[model samples]
Target: MPRYLDRDRLALLAALVAPLAVAVVLLTFRAGLPNTSIALILVVIVVAVAANGNRLAGGLAALSAAVWFDFFFTQPYQRFAVTKSVDIQTAVLLLVVGLAVSQLAARARRLQVVAITDADYLARIHDTAELAQSAKEPDTVVDHVTAQLTTLLHLRGCRFEYGSLIGHPPRLEPDGTVVWGRKRWDVDRLGLPNREIELRTFGNGRFYGRFMLDPTPGTIPPLQARLVAVTLADQTGAAFGTVGSG
Candidate 1:
């Protein structure tokens, strides 16, 4: 069985049957011949299936219409066999055209959906980057990072730990080391197999404490990871200014 059919059999069935039902109603109750109305109804069915995010459903709808058209609309009503040559040719042409139209429309709809999803992702990333850049205080930055990470990646929690190199490394207390600068990554380590996104600011051959993200597996793609790294680096550079420049 096809994946789409397996995933959405009921929707596929509805897409296939609704147009035929409309055509039957048109033939039985409304008038003698459906004329252009039948074709319009079939087009509507294709559009509806495409709108529902199943391009295969559109093709299925077209196939169902061909079968229904031959059985009901063609001469010698309620029969699979067609007597007239022109009617047979017309049915074949209708089937071919409907299938082609549905396929093309479905492809366009799929592309549109992808474009919208990508646009939304970009917008959210941009907003997060802006918020990160605008944060002046350490606590504020940590809060923003935690909130954004939770919203963007749906993580359980986020905490940053500044290393010894940044400004001031956290001191080791009597029981454990008290890290002042480094954001805590202990919670992140609890989640298995996570990607650590590290962003660094380099000046005078020295690296500043950078932003880090522990992302869930398969949630962040390579290209997106690279982009986030670049954005964070840019934001850190803007915050600290050029340390070595004359």
Candidate 2:
């Protein structure tokens, strides 16, 4: 599955399905004639809304039920405009139920999203911790970290550069090279001709180096940057241990 949720498609599907499901349920109970159960229809609407996780679906289901109830089930049937007091109460109740269910379902969906994000973040942290503990050589750690990051974020390619920043910034060729920033070290988003991601890593309050992604520019978002930072910091700390403060 794609990492991000496609809200537009979900909303569109909810809008289309809710009314159709309600219509089907209404038709099923119609054979009994004058025995239509408004409670059953409301239950169906609530289920549909909860299953779909959309407010639009719930609202549409409520409206469809109200219209069907007045025209088919109410006395002096076959008209939209309600004339009876009890019918008015039923319509009001349907609206309230639909809105309430939809609100609750939406809240649940939001929680599910947050949980998924947190899980991904924790998994990244676990991977970094494992790399820090297991790798004896800094290059081995860097290569392992790069491979893990590429797999985790689904990047086409990744490279890490190490060394102090001095002299003019090195030309960031299609391949990787270390470069100096104009001034103090910071994470600068470098734009390439094609859609590529460039992440600069800083550690111990100083610039370490750049993490380059293949092709174009602006491909990596902020969350990915933080993950890369954690992995890079692990590798950099390992490098310092091996080389003794380069």
Candidate 3:
């Protein structure tokens, strides 16, 4: 969404404009324009739209291209009703090619976006680790980790609580679905606001300290976020290695 037009609106405009542009191109070579040429042109349009992550617009462009082919290029010129079997086949092929190309292009675009998103997560984790490494005190490390975790998980609040933490056995849900108490977070109550996820900083069965995150509603913390939290907690614990528990 930009200042001028949102993504959906831009897609809609592309859907309407792209097919018309292709039709104009077809009109220039109306005669002797092979059925293959029309199909190729329409496919190019569909792919262009779909590559922009606008599959709905690509589908609309595909349909329009099919209609334009029948109306302008077929024997029944200026009409959608195609009489010749060959023309009918060309029209059908044009539509199928557009749709197929659009599907493939859209899937590629989605995968590209996912790849970029994962890269961002990695970059954030790396930066946060570097920041934590430079921190001198346990509280400073905890504050930095809390800030990073809050932003990463879209949580409401997060902080470190120092105390003797009770160890719980690692277990799964009653339904045997998702892991619940990984460290000390309840997974059964997923999507519930104010849910706290506390990970212990201590390693080797020693009680050091704990960091807690209050997840915002509607956010089921991803696995990467959990891993990062656990790692941050460990780093914080190491910084407070010899300090007395709060």
Q: TM-scores of the models, in the given order?
A: 0.39, 0.36, 0.43
lDDT tens per residue, model 2, 43-105:
355535543545555566556655666666566767677777766765555554444344444
**lDDT rank, highest first?**
3, 1, 2
Query: lDDT score, residue 13, model 3?
Result: 80
User: Stretches of candidate 3 above 4 Å error?
Assistant: 1-5, 113-246
Better of 1 and 3 by lDDT: 3
- Against the correct fold, how does model 3 do in TM-score? 0.43
Instruction: Tell me how far the alpha carbon of residue 125 in candidate 2 is from the true structure, in angstroms, after superposition.
Output: 42
TM-score of 1: 0.39
Return whichever of 1 and 2 wins on TM-score: 1
Model 2: residue 148 alpha-carbon error in angstroms: 52
* lDDT against the true structure, each candidate: 0.49, 0.49, 0.61
lDDT of 1 by residue, 77-142 (tens): 889988887567556645554554454445445434321113333334334344443455434544
Scored against the true structure, residue 26 in model 3 reaches a CA lDDT of 74
- Judged by whole-model lDDT over C-alpha atoms, candidate 3 comes out at 0.61
Clashes of 1: 11
lDDT of 3 by residue, 48-72 (tens): 7766746787788778888877888
